[model samples]
Target: MNWMDSLFHELQTIPEVAGLAAADDTGTYIAGMNIDDTDEFAALLTFIGRSGLALEEHLGLDPLVYTSLSGKKIKLIVHRILDYFVGIRLSEKSSISKVEGRINSIVGNLDIEDE
Candidate 1:
């Protein structure tokens, strides 16, 4: 199965998760659908982030499985979801400067350094 399908399946296993599959454009497109509030979104993001990190920790694991472009794409997608949630949380807390600092930190930490 594709990553999106795997994501949906993983979400389904979590009892707290709620929401249609990503393929459900009708459900996803509804006005103010509140995907943020849906437990599935939160759970799925957490799962992907944690699993990716775990995979990275294991030596001799198949690089093709965990370090491939597909794997990085999954991580990037999770990061984007986290960034979205961070924005919403910051809005609620009225902490734009705090969020900006966090984004800066993330970028600075991840940016390639000169050898």
Candidate 2:
């Protein structure tokens, strides 16, 4: 497996994640699961991540680590990790705090990319 694949696999171990995907800084789909249109999703993730960074800059706030949007049936959590962004889709009722810890753990242990 590639680096992104391994990381995504680890993320899949989280029980609450119904779907997940990753995008590079350029908004290209790196890897994903359960997402219908990987290209569109990746693009959306890039837009969201960029917008967050722009807003933080304007407000003089700390860089964004992650963000979430909740809907009636699903919750979308997006994390900016290194030069990539990962989006996790969870059931609306899932415990976000529980999943956040696991996400951080996986991201924290990310291996250095092969040179």
Separate clash counts for every candidate: 0, 0
Which pairs of residues collide in candidate 1? none
Report the C-alpha lDDT of model 1 over 1-115, residue by residue, as the tens digit: 2333333443344332223222121122211122554455445544554555566677545421211112321211223221221111212323333344443344234423321
Candidate 1 — worst ten consecutive residues by lDDT sum? 82-91
lDDT value for candidate 1?
0.32
What does candidate 2's lDDT look like per residue over 1-115, in tens digits? 3767777788888888888898988999988999988999899888888889999999999889888877786688888977888898886789787788888878778885671
Over 4 Å off in model 1, which ranges?
1-37, 60-76, 80-115
Report the number of the highest-TM-score candidate.
Answer: 2
Candidate 2 Cα errors over 4 Å, as ranges:
113-115
RMSD of each: 16.0, 2.0
Count of clashes in candidate 2: 0
Q: So what's the TM-score on candidate 1?
A: 0.28
